[model samples]
Target: MSQVLSVNVGAGADKPYAKVRLTGIDKRPADGPVAVRAPGPKRGVSGVAGDFIGDERHHGGDRQAVYAFQREDLDRWQGELGRDLPNGCFGENLTTVGIDLEQVLVGERWTVGDPADGEALELEVTDPRIPCRTFSGFLAERGWVKRFTADARPGTYLSVVRPGQVRAGDEVRRTFVPDHDVTIGLLFRATTTQRELLPRLLVARDYLDAETRSLVERRETFTLDDA
Candidate 1:
């Protein structure tokens, strides 16, 4: 029964992020309430469906994003870094209330909207965000992004399953969609060190994207035993 405490968009109004500076702004998930939606015609990522809130240039990577987190992570980080900068400095899109960051796995579903609006939106949790130089710059720590990324405990990326509008203070409820199915987690595992799990993950092929699907297919075709 998690609710969207806040739905934040962009880095900041005054300083909307560009490719380069998008890295500097500490885009923390808001702890209030906000509205969300599939960006409209003017907002489409270079003009396409299912392309909202991310860099259009990089379709399959870390763009169209959302985040769910526990307040405890913020509290812990605040003690460590809040003294010098704003709290929750990572600039996440959605700051979730009562959602456990660790528990929001890939394939999870979140229903979010105001009941009166009759516009509930379901978002499927995708992959864990990989840390980048921007994250390091914001925290002023050399590898805070890696620290969060290594554990794969960072909040999740969401793909819009059912597109609609979300407003600040709108209620968001997340339902675990069942981990028994194949998921983005398995994809990440297959791509990385967990090569042994790749075959098992392939059984869940429908979940794979064009980019990842191609990579996995190529890998399977190769005879790794000799190489």
Candidate 2:
């Protein structure tokens, strides 16, 4: 069954590997339920209570309130890297199982936990998690950014549609799926290795985060200018 294998949160700490001297990328599994909600308009505010965001300019906000990574993908990476990567190793708030995150549509909505309990968390998939220098430094793997982008399973970033609480082992149910074909994988490729596919991402413009929307718009302008 599709469920949250673990809910993770990180405390802000100084790390030499981080571009910002301080980073919250070393997340650890939480012991109990964690509150989930939309972050403030400002950057670097995490949606999950007690969670920390390191980079104000590039991380967090309402559009990137939560991040999730699949256990299947983690296992695959573990095999390739020959190391033990536990839940939250990738700085994901939720470590999930039984969901193909890469194939999830950009606007797909998920109800996490039991709705009958009146505390189910509603999350909308907004964009793919792009690999950055922070992530590369965290892993200490050579050519990590290029390798991750090439692999194209960039995980998923989500916005909290309804504030609630989430815990490990909670069920995750897909309540809605957008009609567009802009999956997380497609969006990642479009913004990275496959610039030619950027035009196709316009079909799901309503679901894209601000950064992605701006990228598409800039690309469109560039195309028109060259024409």
Query: lDDT tens string, model 2, 2-113?
Result: 9999999999999888879689999999998999999977889999999999899889998789999999999999999999999999999999999999999998999999
Instruction: Judge candidate 1 at residue 54 and give its lDDT.
Output: 35
For model 2, the stretches where C-alpha displacement exceeds 4 angstroms are 218-227
lDDT score, candidate 2, position 122: 95
For candidate 1, give the lDDT of residue 72.
Answer: 60
Task: Give one digit per residue, the lDDT tens place, for model 1 in 64-117.
Answer: 444445456666666766554333355555666666656554566777775455
* Per-candidate count of clashing residue pairs (backbone under 3 Å): 13, 0
Best by lDDT: 2
lDDT computed for candidate 1: 0.52
- TM-score of every model? 0.67, 0.95
What lDDT score belongs to each candidate, Candidate 1 first? 0.52, 0.92
Candidate 2: count of backbone clashes, pairs at least 3 residues apart or interchain: 0
